[model samples]
Target: MRTHDWFSRKKDCDDKGDPEAVFNVLDSMLKDSLERLKNMRESIPLENVGFDSCTLEAVNSRHATLFGCLCSEGKWKTALWLRRKLIQKGAVLDVFAHNLLLNGLCKIRDMERPDCLIREMLEMGPPPNLVTYNTFIKAHCLKNNVDKALYLFSTMATDGIRPNRVTCNTLVHALCKKGLVDDAKKLLCETLSDDKEKTNSDLITSTILMDCYFRSGDTVQALGFWDQMLHKNIQIDLVAYNVLIHGLCLGQHINVAYGNFAEILKRGFIPDCFTFNTLISALCKEGKVEEACHIHDVMLKMGVAPDKISYKMIIQGLCFRGDLVKAIEFLNCLLEKSLMPEPLIWNLIIDGYGRCGDLGNALSVNNHMLSLGVAPNVFTFNALILAQIKGGNNVRAYSLKKEMLLNGLFPDLVTYNMLISAACISGHIAFALDLYDEMLRKGIEPDIITYTELIRGYCMRGNVKEAEKLSTKMRRSGSQIDHVPCKILIKKYCHLGEHDMAFHLYQNWLMREK
Candidate 1:
């Protein structure tokens, strides 16, 4: 019914003997439907739209594109509904169409529909292709249902559908993600030995295993696999080069990673931001800031504009190396380049300044962030509060806490903990207790750290009985209370000449441990 205009427009143009007008109107209608296919498919009649072969082909092509978009957006139910509409309209939902639906079901983890669709595909005559089985297999693998995935793999041979590179890649990547790199390696060898032509899949599998091995801190095997990949002449791509470099860097084999970077450039492949970031991160992590900076300069000279991630990594590297001044300088440089530092970058720089005992500079950074209209979150507030506390200005910290509340920012665990600890340290037991009550009223679950700080405050006030009550609550809070606080309490009791009470508490603790 919605397509009535399309037909009427075509007929009117045809009657006027304007063939060009007819074609233009039909083309425009098809384009409009393509843009809103998700909406059009439900309302438009596919069976008797009075379209020729060319327009009909356009409809089918648009349907295919629409199916892909739906799957990508995870609208599995709508995609299924569209399939039913097509079938009811007597549109021949081809093998590719069915496969797209199957992929959608797999993506949404709709187990029952996928099985039904597979069964229907088997009965309806267009046999399931390798892509169909691969989708199902990859889905099961991702869900950690590896047994089902393997079963599907085994059944592929019986169904006479040969598994391809994508199939192998899916299974291998899943195994690696589950930290079963050894199992992945075994599968890789078995598959490659059975089918020698799966070289591309082998490259992907090898890269996955290399990254996994590095993550598990097994540098020997990671490098060995890298060597094996090269010896086999697998025609490594830029992606493969990047993976090996990252793995080698993660394993602290920066020299080898650098060598691989040189090899990548020599092979006429342009290194991406990932390549430079990986190398820079590795160098910075090793406290080789000079080398990292040199690489940063080289990256700029190579015409690859450093992104936010690149700057963040360098800033973090500088922070870790105790170069807060340089970190702030870099932040200023980023601002000068019209690159507004992200909240995370600002947080890191603020924290770096705090660590270097420059509370003034930290607060200065916070103020700069505010002036730029970058609304500070709890992390920003917490950092500033922490700097104030560290600078022995608890009053300023409290004022910031008030300012944070005025701005409607809910204080998280760290915020409360910092405030509580600072209050206890300054012997403001009453204020600490009030903050604790406020934290509870806000539904923020207090951890052992909170309890320990409160207990210490009570003990400092010579209120051992109140401290004991807090200790009992700490034990029941499902948080691990460290023995340091218990030791402190024991020392307090001994100082009070209450040795019997101290011994009783120690015996109770021993009994609980047993």
Candidate 2:
């Protein structure tokens, strides 16, 4: 129903009254839309009444008398400058010349190539009128240049040009977007005072101003604007409500956001995919997994099929909660419904599996990630290394580590820690020490966990002298030694009847606790 009103005006001459005139009007309308064509689907009729040459001849003409015809034909906004440029190249001008050029250049907003021509027009003796200024203001507003626009607007009355409703809306939106809330409110008040029908009469522009306030994280001001718009009985679009909901959700003001949505529904603004996703993501961010899941169910009950992103959010929420079984089930269900998970989804599962110490499952998930054509990232490799090392798959873990190095994912301290833990557990204390040294050489200092594992490995090997030396070095380096490793050294020395060394170990543990 919201089509271009292309078939109205000058339709007074019916088919029988003037067949040629009716055809002319119909032909002109479809030849163009408002501005630049997004796509040229059947841009022109292939069959042109057997006059293809005549149709081709209508391409670009610079005569000002052709303004009415040009405006009636293809979009003139972007074409305005080009036409004016041709006119400056010694083309003749006519009465409708300024109107055609104005509509082409400013009306539809093809400012991309209007710079030089616009300057030339400004320098010309023929001054622009109110409509021209309004068009220019709208262009500036659209481009978010409120300052220049405001300067131009303040001088409008000096040029015998009065700002209209559209002009007021543009100024308000530009000011609001530029963080000039008080200025926008003042302008809004002025417009409302001067023009009784200005506030609510143009819902589209008012809604746009409301959105500017909404996106600024000014909920109170945004709602205030919304209430004002409503008092004027302005129509609210679904996207407008969705935008407010997005701000509310982002700000974690969910209760009020929900209230807005309820009112939106009452006002006939239907919720859509974007609406659901924003709310679900917000809840998930707050770690409210239950609320997120409930929302997902609500989406389905409303007969709206959850999109891949919706399922992804739920899976990530479950994964964060360590509910792997449910996450896996949900993943399987997603696949059952033919939803191929994106790379992000794969990363979530890999991270989940790694955190749960299920290296085998983690690797499986990673393999599936690769199979889905998702290239592994640094975080993916980090998770994979942690899982492999913790699961005792040292050989595969090392192999993967080598591959990770080859793929440019240099092992950081955490990666080295996981691999070193595996090495220490396998009685490869020398290898663990080598890794620790390499980590230090790479400027990756080992953490408390790393040194503890190394000390424990040394203690287990009856290398009490080496363990004591390492512990003293760790303490000097500001790394705290733990009790379990101390217990290991003490128990080993006690079992061997080395009472002095055992007593020394006990003394070290007692000192560490302090």
Candidate 3:
């Protein structure tokens, strides 16, 4: 049978009071609707494809289930259509269904609709429950709107719904994220005092608090929390151990962190990506790239797949230590593993080669990136332009700027500064001035560097008056005249045998300093 005919026959069977037939129809329709929703390139009017009143009434009892399924799949518009249809049919969803919808909305960061829905639930029947409140609290907390989350937490008490462990943990995490560790600790202590039994079972909350204290540089308190967890016979997990390891690394105690890593292995707990990443990052920062590389090899040998962050940290370490050859090897290894490193990673290699005056490799890497379909960003272009300028190829650097515009990327402050400085150095003062004018037209405000370059350009061409006027404008624009430009003007005056004018300029500088 054709697909539409099959659906129609199932609907006819449903109408004949065959309950099993009705469920089969629902299952088929749900699958079709979800597929259509997934395939839509852009949202269209829901009325065109959504169930009408007649069709909604056909699957009367399963409406909430259907709505929940739609919400779970993140088809918000379709879910909204179903919700409106159910309300128009005077079908009231239970608190559970309402909570599911609210959760879905929160996940999409649709704060406005969720607020309205919660208000409707509060004013009408099927009032919000613990899950409903927790969903909102967690959503708000995730957005860093901790003030709003705290308001919701207090409102829950007024609604006679006691906050549970999930609620407490969410709030504690948010507070700690905002650097309010003391506030988080206070809240955790109050909650523990209220429910003594919770203190023993709440490993997550304790771990968060310990991590918070460690981040805030309170190693004593962090260790105290760890000792308390052990004394209370709380089961330590891999996450807690990772936190302790991370804290020790943060405290510059790499030896202690490694000791804990060995302990973790002895205890039969596998160190995951995070555990390895933390140690690698710390060792890289400490200029121990060899040690970090060994750990990377060890993790791979142990069949623990390194993530992008793992590769990124190790690559960055190699690049920072000027080991471009090793960095490129890692980049190729990342590609061999079918993991596409982001353009920033590619940029790092380009920049490393550029820093070593290897413009050939820099351009080659850039071409390779394009061949792999990764468009170079402004930073990539800036690094290339700098390399060209350093190679005394000013024309090529200017041509790159034109290429940037063709690629729909406008010249930023750094781009303008580099080109302008290059132009001034090559005695193209007229072109440098034109670029300065272009910068102003493009609304790119000139900083002290821009003015300094322009002033030096003028002084080099023996246009002392123009340089002095530009210096006055620079001060008026709130940029302090640094020693470079000031000395340039004074030397220019002295060179032209204008001793009085040079003395006057020096006296003015002293007055400003005073």
- Best candidate (score: TM-score): 3
Name the candidate that leads on lDDT: 3
Who is ahead in TM-score, 1 or 2?
Answer: 1
Candidate scoring better on lDDT of 2 and 3: 3
lDDT of 2 by residue, 1-514 (tens): 1122333423663323544665786677767653335334234333332545554344323355456566666656435654555455434333235545655555445665443444555576246666667767777777777776887788788777777777887787778777787787788667555656654545656576667776777777767766776686766678768877887786789988888878877887668888889889988899998898888888888777889989999999999899888888878878888888876777788888887788878878888778877788767887887777667678877787788878877887777888888888899998998898898898997877887788778867778788777777877897655676667667878878999979976876787678
Over 1-514, each residue of candidate 1 has an lDDT whose tens digit, in order, gives 4444555576434433656766797799889888898666655555465668787677677788889899889888899888887776667666787788788888777678998888888897358888899989988987899888989898998889888767877888888878888787677667655656667767777888888888888888888888898899888999988888888888778888889899998999989999999988888788888788788789889998777777888898888777887888778878888998899888988887776668988988888998998999889988888888889998998898888889998789999999999899889999998999999999999988898888888888899999998898888877887787788789899999999999988988788788
Please list the residue runs of candidate 2 whose C-alpha ends up more than 4 Å from where it truly belongs after superposition.
Answer: 1-85, 88-114, 124-180, 187-222, 247-256, 301-305, 329-340, 408-417, 420-514
- Model 2's alpha-carbon lDDT is 0.73
For all predicted structures, in order, the TM-scores are 0.74, 0.60, 0.79
Q: How close is candidate 1 to the true structure, as a TM-score?
A: 0.74
Models sorted by TM-score, best on top: 3, 1, 2
Error of 1 at 279 (Å): 2.3
Please list the C-alpha lDDT of all candidates, in the order they appear.
0.84, 0.73, 0.88
Q: Which stretches of candidate 1 lie over 4 Å from their true place?
A: 1-82, 104-115, 189-197, 333-340, 355-360, 371-373, 391-393, 406-408, 440-514
